[model samples]
Target chain A: MARVELNGVRKTYPNGFQAIHGIDVNIADGEFIVLVGPSGCGKSTLLRMVAGLETVTDGEISIGERVVNQLEPADRDIAMVFQNYALYPHMTVYNNMAYGLRNRGTPKDEIEKRVRKAADILELSEDQLARKPRQLSGGQRQRVAMGRAIVREPEVFLFDEPLSNLDAKLRVQMRLEIKRLQRSLGTTSIYVTHDQVEAMTMADRLVVMNGGRAEQIGTPMEVYERPATVFVAGFIGSPAMNFLEGRAEGGKVVVNGAAGLAAPADIPDGPVLVGLRPEHLAVVDGGAAMLELAAEAVEPLGADTLVHGRLGDGQLVTIRLSGTPTFGEGDRIALAAEAANLHFFDPETGRRI
Target chain B: MVENRPFATFVSHFVLILGVAIVAFPIWITFVAATHDGVRITQVPLPLLPGDQLFANLESAFFTGVGNAREQSVGMMLFNSLVMALMIAGGKIAISLLSAFAIVYFRFPFRMGFFWMIFITLMLPVEVRILPTFAVVANLGMLNSYWGLSIPLIASATATFMFRQVFLTVPDELLEAARIDGAGPLKFFRDILLPLSRTNIAALFVILFIYGWNQYLWPLLVTTDKSMYTVVMGIKQMLEAAEESPEWHLIMLTTLLAMLPPVLVVVVMQKMFVKGLTETEK
Candidate 1:
């Protein structure tokens, strides 16, 4: 219903400690933007600022072309599903779903109708709807929390780590469920999460943040394939993008005691680093200018394996390989980085070269 | 397990029975004292059974002493006590709830200092402030009236403190949800905060009810008229009315009747009170 734009928004606590350092984000109408970051990275704080839960310390926030820096959270036309669910323990699921509508002065019959409709969409049984949140399972409670938001039919749906409390399997299931729900509803949603996988899988556009600044904003694939900065490359992927410390000279990047690979670009004068994705490193027979590893350990999964090793200058690197590696701990192996997949960064500033 | 532990179970039952007896004895004493006649009550060994003197003692207790003001009857005194308790309880709860909501939900200048000041009132007993409170109420022209008797005794520091404690435990998320739901402070308190505080409300009701029902000194000082005498004061008046000999049996019986309402409320709701107290408010 609305495209929310945080134009130079900032938040500072009363004691004058700044939490958000003037963030500017423009989310299109009906866009699903995921704010992803490590803990204390100000992602949730930024989302809350958009939702108007937090007071805007400095700049303007506009939703649907109307400035709402001074608007109340409810008046902002955004419904947020909190991390703890925050279900009214005394109220039944039905009432919980109807709470927003009732507060908005919706008709008694309409509240009931909308509540029943939401309950059906959430797959809540009549019995579950009548039961208190305390009696419901965690996933069920989460659904009721979702129902509480959906019944409002707000301009934006803000989710604050909503699935963090669920079990691993439930988190995955709920993650897909939420993605499908957002797709069908097409509400402008801003979901905050620390889980990279959640951000990678669910976001239409991922806004990766660090230290109160937006690290990168793009499609998940774009962030993965072409990270603009070193932090974005490392934070977006699990086990992280491998960084090999070396110097760029004579059209080649060299790591001590390892074979040097030809640099893609004109020789960056001196200090440089090579970044490679784990999955892109194909295990080839030892030869040529490809990086050779003295494997430190091998972690095998039923589906795939991860090879952990130390680069010559001792940066920890992990490689994703298919099937259990026949190679054991401390085996000598050769890894070839797909030329297109290799990323070059300036060693001092960490900006991609 | 039952088959394996018969003797241990029997001992447990025996201990339970003793505990029950210990709890039941005070009530039992009141009942027996109510039934005994004058001479038997004053005798070395008190009457342990209901006696024929019950009706006569009741009749005198109801109809004696200082005129229609009912200084004569413990029955009139019981009515006064009930009226006073209900008023005080209702008034105390109403004031405390508002103050609690203000302090708990809203941020104001000097909010912490205000909270500390209110909490300090609890540390200072009503007994200590009775003279000053009475003076203030008297000066306000509320003496000898129901309003006078009720208002001063019913403003509770403890109720507000307890309610704030409960509000503190309520997840910040719930309040945030209500705000996002478009509720202002008034609507938020009415729809969410008040309802969620059912346990604390019950606990405060219990405390306020007992405080009002059992108050002796404040009402005694405020209501100089005999007709307005509370049940606590009524019992003291019983001795004065006894021209020849005091009817200790009648006095005890009337006291038991006066104590019933609050006693029953506590009996039924004591568990809720404890449950309310134990909450983490996290």
Candidate 2:
């Protein structure tokens, strides 16, 4: 396994379109780093640069002790699993797994042993290994793809939304399987996906990207709990963190012309964007309520109820409370969160306070 | 179609039967004419039923050959035709496949320019450039050779375009995956691209084999030697002798023998041909 480093890597298309502005990431050996973003966010481009599939255009990428910017993908000692599986359709599963070894001129017996071992690890039966990719089910094909990557035993593994083609149930199962496999193999891996849940669950550290730049890169919880920018706070969590326009003065914030909301301590006397996570809020007693919400809709999930409503200041917010909620649509509820759960951002720069 | 109207069904069956009769009548005449002696064939109100000269005509055509083209046996002419067809089909596929691979995969300078240049040759067929091609073949001393017969006809733009379409449909990820699998450009073409185009190649082979087999004018222009005469040209030579004594039975027999190899090719690879034209397997 090798640690990978991307030092100010950039990708610029020939037509003057800049897909990746500049990204610098230092990935530790055996660490699973996930590049997560929306479409056109340059996450996939960054992953392809690391895979040596796309030219770096600028900056240096090194695997182990050698700079790999000039290396071909095969010489870079990396294996990739594409979103579509990209299995060789004409070859049997065994040949698909053994193709790389054969191309590298590995001995026939050694190639067979490695392919058989990979198939065994992937739970593919002997008969299944002899069958072509089209003859296998979607999940089985996915396993064969993984087997193809595993048999190579490359220094690093690259997964480009490998599970996105599977059904929802299979996606979750494969997600767990991939995480477990990566942990056991301890290969430095870079995974790219548009799904935040996959990033949150599968990554040892997450690099949240936006507009071709790395907005925040940290452990999942660190990025979630203490977002560095307004975009990170909005993108990382489910039900998304809610934002409200408010004025900070003295030691408190004023919203809807009412000056009673508790603000974080390190605030200047200026306008600030207040962020409150949906799960951090609770239904408080009427007299103890810091914000009053007019419930517009309620989604009753089994373990939690989400109340999407407008606050007194006319800003939309969502509140997640444990168990079933007594409030329904059109019900006015009092909501409050601890001072530490609140997030403050500078309105002008979108930087966290 | 789902309604299953009786009048529509009857009309459709009648039209289909009429079409079959129109196509099959000439072949039936040829078969019947081959079964009779030349005197019986030349008789007015020609016999539609079989005569007992079938084996006699077969033996005469296979051993002695047709009248005007009798210098070389009909069997030898068939062999020459088979060689030309196979070479033309094989050579066209090889050249077209390589050209399509280069056009689709590589990003060289003037790539599309090269493709359009090849494609433009489709408008300039052999007949249009026959004199120049003949001069080149004569200058190279390839006249009276199998290479002279097939080489000028082997550069097929249609097959190249078809293979190009086939290669374009292949997902880009497969190329990327192969690159990561340590395959170089030519290795990927051999191991991945060629195998994937198997059915398409089969389909094109059937068509090109028939085209080469039916070629009459090009071989006539190139080969002055009787040994290099293809079967299609053999039939034409026999017809030219009809101005004197028309060996109708032997000529009909030669036509029947000339149809066999192409028909066998189509029948043998019918499944692959259909699949290649209709479906693209990944």
Candidate 3:
């Protein structure tokens, strides 16, 4: 139950390699904030700093009101669940959950009461509690890991790609479990993950990071609907937002060898990139003006479909369709996105125009 | 293989018999001799089977009245040997574990220097510096005591090296997880590191037990009193008793007695030793 804040935190290795650039963000108490990005994006490093597992080379990290820059992890009053679930392989599930409490000298009966309560919430039976970690399934081990964190009733919870190690089904299941657990506990949680769906579904607010800098921080829908930067737009969505080279002039954007389209208000006219979400690709509904392209690949996933194709200037792009289109590879198609759905970016700066 | 198993079995037995003889014949010699009359047992065609003089010799081992020299019983000598080996083994293993725990888990100044100290010890055997070591120990006022016998010999640089290597295999996530759970350095060491290293401890135990049991020159140098003699010293004494004409049977029997503790420790902890060695490679 604490707000976590990072004030211009920076981390640099001894050999002069800086991994986390100075970044600042504040997590309000009881908010589930996710740091999402691709591999090597430094999201995990930032999370580890908050967890007090990694040292901050510059600035400060404070849990609630206390600046914990020099505090040990134990003194930080935070609990973290790692991607691998780092269960004590030698201990029974009960002992694994009770270890931190026992370390704090919690009375045996009280420890048992809290451990049993956590186990009940996680749906771990007495029989399961008696079993060692290696005997349990992957999901069970993860729950035991959560149970360990939950019993602490920590001020803040840090998850470093906690569900990344689980299979697809279990990842999804645990995703819901973590969201529910956070909601019930009402503790400030900072989760790091590479998967966008997990971020979108699980984050109360999503902080998308790139190359050691946070690109944007917003509610999940806000990031999805109005990505602050081209990178955020390209990274936040799957079959990511496609970009095509273009130029803006006189309130209008012109594609190379293509029709003129009116630019959004506030677009600067030197050089621009047209950002298009695949789902916005309006396939010719028989009456609308269209841009024709030849489909290169058709991936039908039953509910929706993705059409990967090339435009007139041989610019490669992906088109997402609502219904399975009767389209085949090498077939010609006409598609157009609505003017409102078009996202324009300044070409030179790669920032939203 | 099962249908003609007897023919296959005979082939197996043939190889197995050769292996067993190669591995066990020396042991057979030791055991057979440990149970015989000191004079008759060393004849050219040594007895293929054990002799019946075991009880009398055993009695004589206990009865200093039977042997020409006044000495403590071989039983008392073995007890002394146990105390020596256990002290050395326990001291070295415990110290190595704590030091390894520090080196492997904690980050501090001169970490590499501490590691190099152990590595240097492993690289240089004490035999090269025996006289200086004796001088040091004697100057420390530890002469004629277990501390004198145990201190120089308990460096256990090799065991510490092995433990550090084994400790390197533990996942970083485990340590991070423990840290996040509010376990500090001491609790982490006691609760997680120590428990997970059961196999390594057993492995180190066997290795140190053998090392301590077989220790000779240091113990021989420090322990001057006949009562303070370890089993190995007693065995060497039996060999030197007659000087020019040594008691080979007594020497062999005493040597066999000297080897028993280590052999038993190994047999009991063999599984852990193998696991400890192989798991580290993994």
Candidate 4:
């Protein structure tokens, strides 16, 4: 219901460890912004700062029009779903969902109506509503957690890795459910997760973070198709983007002791790193092969076969091909990628060329 | 359980039985003496068997009290002991819970300093500071009152420390959830924390109740009025009276009554007590 904006938000712990450097992100109303990063990359810290759970060492956060840097979490009108689901272990599902409404002094009938509606939306039956959180299955507990947030009718929702505790299958189901729920509720939500897949699928506009800084923020397709930096290029894809160290010379990238590869025309003559996503690489016929790889291992995943190997210049590379591939270990395979699919970055600064 | 060795099992059972007998011997002797007449109780080695005076001795202890020391009924003393024990137990749990919640959740100046001051009281027990504590109670004009009997002993460090440890084990996420739920401090304490620590409170109540009921030296120093005498200290008065005129049956009868409440509490709530002692949460 409200747009959230963080202007130069930072978090510095009391021990003088700066977990989050200054980060500025403006999320439109009803947008799902997923902050994705590896461990200790300040994604959770940034989310907590927005939630008002952690103090902002520097900068301002605004939920709607009011700057909420000084407001308490309760006063900020936001509800957070924790990674552990954090349901009150002693309270039944009905009471847990009703807790916030009751605390806000909503009328009793209104509280019951909202709780029942949320439970219905979450598909928690009457019998399940009476049970404690410990008695519910892991997926059901996660639903109740979402139900708790849904009944709040708050301005924004904060999910702190809410689906990380579920099994693989359940995580996918809940991920879709959460996406549908957020769309239906039209609530601005900020989800934090270390899993890039969750970030890619759930985020309307994803924020890729690295070393306490926002590396890139854009739509999933945009960030995937055009990653801004080497970190984003390496992090966004499933098998990760393969990087080859080469020098740019006269509008071409030359790998030492290997054949020269095509580079984007705008890239200047200097040390550059070439990135090619695994899915973008194709196994080519003998005559048109652009790069030769010595296959070290092969993973046949039914839908896509992944070939992990070393390139001619001794760089580790992974190539993804559709359906089953007949490639075997130690097979010298020729692979080719279109010039438009290639990513170019500077070796010194790791910035995009 | 892993290996069924008959000889080892037999030795374990035999040792446990021996320990039980050693502990129960005094209670057996007290029971035997209470069942006998005054003259029979005063006889050598006491009566090993019941002597038909059990009901009579119980009635005398309940209605007319033991010997003739200050003429207050043992029933009245038992009532006083119950009041004092309940007050101490309830008061200690209430204060310790609040203090523990404050110390664990809030940030303020001198917080650790105040916690350490409360902790320091553990090193200075009532036995060590009896005179000054007695003076404070007497100056408040609370002598011979229930406040005099319980309040001075209610500020417990052990219960506070136990509750603090319990609160620390609670995940920080629960607090964040509560805060987002719009629950202020008091509501969170009532609806969440108090319920979670229910078993611990019951267990601590058992311990603190027994401690309060068994008080001898402090109650002996404070309550000069016979009506205010608790049953445990009242037993000492009965024993002193028995020195002049042997009323061993009546004295033993009062001693039995004094020990019954705490024993029954432990026996009845044994499950919760064990759960509280061993496990913090499900």
Candidate 5:
């Protein structure tokens, strides 16, 4: 219902270990922002700070129009679904969803109506609503957790890896359900997960975090296509973006004392890291070759063949090709990439050049 | 179970039966002695079989106590013991639960210092500090009251430690969820924590009830008036009177009554007690 803004927010433990650096992100109303990172990257900490579950050490967080740094989580008008379903094991599903409203002193009829409505939206049957959380399957328990959040009807929803506990097939189904529910409800939401695929599929805009800092924030495609830093470029894609140590000379990248591959024209002549996504590299004949790789291993995944090997300079490289590839181990192959698909980064700093 | 040798199983059953008989021997002897008249009970070798005086002895023990203690009914002493046991068990659970909740959930100054202080009480049992505790009770004018009988015994370190362990095992996310649900500290305790620790509470109640009922030194030291005597202490008084005139049938009957309530409690709540002792949660 309202936008959320974090201005230079940070979190430092009492023992002098800083978990989150100053982070600023402005989420539009009804936008779904997924905070994606590896473990210890502070994604969950940042989300908790927004939920008023953790103290903001340095900056202001405003949900709607009020600065919520000092507000209790309930007073912040937000609901969170934890990684574990966190359903009250003693209470029935109906009571679990209605707990927040009942605590807020909502009338009996209204609490019942809202709980029933949430259960209906979640596709939970009446028979299931009377059962306890332990009686439900993992997926059903997850939906009840969501129903607990939905019945609150708060200004925003916060999901902390809610689907991570589910089985793989159930995770996909719940992911789609969450996406559809968020779209239908149009509630401003912030979801935190370590799965980049979930971030790519579900986020209106994705924030890639690293080392307690927001490394990049953009739409999934925008971040995937033009990652702002070497970290993002390496982190976003499957098989990860391949990097080669080389020096840029006159619009060409010379690697291992060889000058054959062309660099982006804007990259100046200096020591640089050449970045190429695995999918961007194509197996080609000798006429238009970017680099030659000595194939050390091959993984044929039916949909795409992943070739992992070493280049001439002994740097590891991976190349992805469509369909099944007939390449074997220890095969010397030439690969090519379009000039526009190449990324250049300064060797001194990890920032994009 | 893995080998399922019939000879080993027979040996195990025989040993278990022997242990049960050894433990149950006193109760069997008490029942047999209660079935005899006073002269028959005092015979050279007491009768092992039942006599028709069981109901007569029980009625006399229930309506009028043994020997010099006849002024106060044994029934009244049993009632006093029940009240003391219930109060001690209830009071300990309530105090320990609140203190454990405060210690685990809230951070304050000297928190660990206070927790250690409570834990130190475990070493100084009632028998160790009986004189000072009696002085305090007398100063508080609680000397001949049920409060005198139970209150000094209610501040339990073992119960607090057990509850603290149970609370610590509760998931942190449950607290966070309750906070988001707009539940304050007390509501969360009442709604979530109390129910979650129900089995633990029941199990502790069984143990503490027996402890309060079996208290001999503290009750004897505090209650000089015969009317305020608990059943366990009353049994000792009856034995003292038996030195003058042996009322063995009535004394044995009173002993049986004193032990019945706690035994019944354990027997009735055996399942919950075992579950509480073994498992914390689902």
Candidate 6:
């Protein structure tokens, strides 16, 4: 319903500790944007600032063309679902969902109608609506929290790790439900999570943050295929991308303890960092192998086997192979990567080339 | 208790029964004395068994009145005590609830200073500062009135501190959520905090009611009119009649009447009292 924009926003505490250092993101109307990072990386802080829960120390946040830095959270027309499902424990599920509407002085029949509709959409039973929050299971409490937000029909919905409290199976189920709900409602939403998988699956575009700065903001596939920095390449992937210290000289790359590897012509002759995705590496014939790995350990997942080993230069690498692998511990495996799959970064700055 | 160890259970039950007997002996004696006529109650070694004169003695104590305090009946004294206790309990809970809410939630200047100031009053109870308190009440022309008896003992530091602890345990996100729901401070207090602390309030009311009921010295000093006399003070007046023998049966009956309301309060709110003292549910 509204496009939310953050223009060089920063949050500085009174004691001189800075939490968020200048983040800017222009979220389009009805687009779901996710802010994902490790804990203490200021992703939550950024979301809180936009929600008007925290004061913006610098820059402007405008939602629907109005600067909202001075507005209260309620005045900004945003509803947030907390990580712990911050439902009113003493009130029944119906009152918990209708509290905001009642506070806004909505008519009794209208409030009841909206509440019933939200509960129905959330799949909460009629009997469950009359029960208090403590009586509901964890997932049902989460639905009540979602119902509370949806009943308001606010312009923007903010979710702060709402699925993190549920069990694993419920988390997955609720994740799909949330995505489906957002698609049907077409409300502009900003979700914050420390889990990269949640961010990748839920966001129209993901803002991968580190140390209070947006390291990369792109669609999941775009960020995965073309990481802007070594940190992004490492943080966004499961099993993580492996890095090796190497040098590019005279149109060839010489990695430590390996035969000469192919390099793009544009790469300058200097010390560089090489990145290779685990799944991108394939088992090749011995003569065509780009690097020989001294196998150290093996983890056989049902669909794919993970081979963790050390390259000859003593750099550890993990290789994801389809199906069961014939090689076990202490067996050398010949692995090779296509020229396009190798990602190069500068050794000094860790920026991708 | 259900461990299937018969000897251990027997020992524990024996100790509990012994404790109950020790505590209940005086109350049992009071009941027995109330059952006899005045002359029989004053006889040697006192009566250990009930007599048929219990109704006669209760009627005399409830309607006709006791010696030396004959101008006002025992029923009137009980009414006075009831009013004072209810006022004190309700007033203390209200004032302490507001003060505690202010101290915990607001960030005014010198907030902790104000809290410690209230905490310091715990040392200066009515006995310690009775003269100044009585002087102030007398100057305000509240002597021989209900306000003089209840108001002097209403501001409770213990109740304030207890409420502060209860408020502190409430999660911060609840406040944040309520704020986003557009509730102002007073609305939040009435709708959220009061309901959340319901058990604690009930528990504090029970204790404060007893405290107000048992007040003797302050009520004795303030009320000169016979109609203003509290039940506890009336019992002492009954025992101190100089010219004639005390009405032992009537005094015992009045004492039994004085104990009823507080006992009723404790019994009625027993579950909430235990829960309030033990657990803080979210």
Task: Compute the interface RMSD for each candidate structure.
Answer: 2.0, 0.6, 2.9, 1.3, 1.2, 0.9
What ranges in model 2 sit over 4 Å off?
B1-11, B242-244, B275-280
DockQ of 2: 0.85
DockQ of each: 0.63, 0.85, 0.58, 0.73, 0.74, 0.68
Instruction: Give one digit per residue, the lDDT tens place, for model 5 in B12-41.
Output: 999999999999998999989989999899
- Candidate 6's C-alpha lDDT? 0.92
Candidates' chain A TM-scores:
0.96, 0.98, 0.97, 0.97, 0.98, 0.98
Question: Which pairs clash in the backbone of model 1?
Answer: B64-B72, B169-B281
Give per-residue CA lDDT, model 4, range B190-236, as digits (tens). Answer: 98999888888998988999998898999999999999999988887
Residue lDDT tens for model 2, A1-353: 99999899999999988999888899999999999999999999988998888998999999997999999999999999999999998898999999999999999999999988888888999999999898999999999999999999998999999988899999999999999999999999999999999999999999999999999999999999899999999998999999989899986887767645777676899998989999999998998787889999999999988899998768999989889988789999988888889899999999998
Poorest stretch of ten by lDDT in candidate 1 chain B:
B64-73
Q: Relative to the unseen true structure, what is the C-alpha lDDT of residue A24 in candidate 6, on a scale of 0 to 100?
A: 88
Each prediction's RMSD over C-alphas, in Å, is 2.9, 1.7, 2.6, 2.0, 1.7, 1.9
Clashing pairs in 4: none
The pairs that clash in candidate 6 are none
Cα lDDT tens digits, model 2, B1-282, are: 588799999999999999999999899899999999999999999898989999999988888877788777899999999999999999999999999999999999999999999999999999999999999999999999999999999999999999999999999999999999999999999999998999988989999999999999999999999999999998988777644787999999888888889999999999776766564557
Q: What lDDT is reached at residue A210 by model 1?
A: 88
Candidate 1 runs further than 4 Å off: A257-259, B1-29, B43-45, B64-71, B271-282
**Which candidate has the highest DockQ of all?**
2
**Chain B TM-score for the candidates in order:** 0.84, 0.94, 0.85, 0.93, 0.94, 0.94
Q: By summed lDDT, which 10 consecutive residues of candidate 2 chain A come out lowest?
A: A255-264
Per-residue error (Å), model 3, residue A170: 1.0
In DockQ, how does model 5 score against the reference complex? 0.74
The regions of model 3 sitting more than 4 angstroms off are A285-287, B1-12, B38-45, B65-69, B242-252, B271-282
CAPRI-style grade of the A/B interface in model 5: medium
Residue-level lDDT tens digits of model 1 in A1-353: 99888888888999977888888888999899999989998999998888888888898999999999888898888899999998887677888888888888999998888888888888999999889888889999999999999999989999999999999999999999999998899999999999999999999999989888888889999999989889998898877888887887788777765667777767667878788889988888766437777799888887999889876566787899988788888887777876789888887787788
Q: Assess the local accuracy of residue A203 in candidate 3 as a C-alpha lDDT between 0 and 100.
A: 99
Q: Lowest summed lDDT over 10 consecutive residues: which window, candidate 5 chain B? A: B273-282
Predicted candidate 2, C-alpha RMSD: 1.7
